[model samples]
Target: MDFSFPKNERIKSKKLMEAIFTEGKNLNNFPLKLIYLPSDFDDDTQFKVAVVAPKRNFKKAVDRNRIKRLMREAYRLNKGVIFNNSERDFALVFLYLGKEMPDFQLMESKMTGLLEKFLKKIANEEAV
Candidate 1:
């Protein structure tokens, strides 16, 4: 199996996104916070992720998109660490909490750190 999170498993449904905000489990690590709710997709791939940036903080769509793009890229590159754990698909939503416009370098570092924390959390959960 390819131990990578592909685009198909990503959570993009509007209803699913709403449900995650209302009922998803929360996991936080500094500039990033994750609201993960079990996905409806029945597949074995370990996980899927959606990245969100607040519009209130970033008044311009360009800024919002840039941050989201950086976040997704960072997650894509680092998430292999977690995906290697399971063949089952998991749904995840990454929400940016910082108010200011963060540079790509800061976003990349924070995102990597957050991903590492998330991977550890998943490992710990599975061990229980």
Candidate 2:
């Protein structure tokens, strides 16, 4: 499976971002919160993702950027789970709730769990 995170998968729209925060349903896994909305997209990508590291929690821009980068990496690696199972498009935002910095291992593991749960929810399948 392809593991690349291409430019098209990034969520860059202001309106969609607002809609995600306002009306999307959320799934939480500790420091990682997955806010997902089923929507049609012009692109062929199965889902569009945005990563958020709150400025209030992370005061330094460097810290915030680092957290966002880590989250994106985690998502990129694990996103195949979502892509292979879903028949429709979605808008997803990953909101990091940790006040402190996290290692890549932690981020990736949390991302994996969050994604597994998301897949279960979407498929309406019994947990494995």
Candidate 3:
């Protein structure tokens, strides 16, 4: 499976970003909080995502960038978990909330858990 995060799968539209923040449901997974919404898009991709590291929590720009990078890597590697058995498209914003920088393994594990939770939530929503 292709694990590359392409341009079409990155959330870059300003209006959609605003809408997601306002209307999306959020899931808190300690170091990360995910805000996601069902989205309408012309492309066939199942999900588009954005990663954020708040300046307030990560004082240094480098630190924030590093965290964002790690998050992206973990998501890219495991995104298939969310793609399987799903018909709806989604826009997701992953907000890093921790004060301290975490290692790659921790980020991967947390990301895996977060994706599992997200998929279950989506399934529940569809069922209801």
**Largest lDDT belongs to which candidate?**
3
lDDT of 2 by residue, 1-128 (tens): 79998889889999999999899988999899999998899878889999999998989999999999999999989888888887878999999998889999999999999999998898773333
Candidate 3 C-alpha lDDT tens digits along 13-90: 999999999999999888988999998899888899999999988789999989999999999999888887578999
Worst 10 residues of 1 by lDDT: 81-90
**Each candidate structure's count of clashing pairs:** 5, 0, 0
For 1-128, candidate 1 gives per-residue lDDT tens digits of: 44345777587678878888888778777688887766557555457678989988999999999889888877776776666654545678988989987787887788777767766776777789
* True lDDT of residue 73, candidate 3: 100
Q: Candidate 2, overall lDDT?
A: 0.91
TM-score, model 2 to reference: 0.94
Show where candidate 2 strays beyond 4 Å.
125-128
Candidate 1 wrong stretches, greater than 4 Å: 1-6, 43-45
Residue pairs with backbone overlap in model 1: 44-87, 45-87, 45-88, 45-89, 46-88
Error of 3 at 126 (Å): 0.6
Q: Rank the candidates by TM-score, best first.
A: 3, 2, 1
Residue 4 error, candidate 1, Å: 8.1
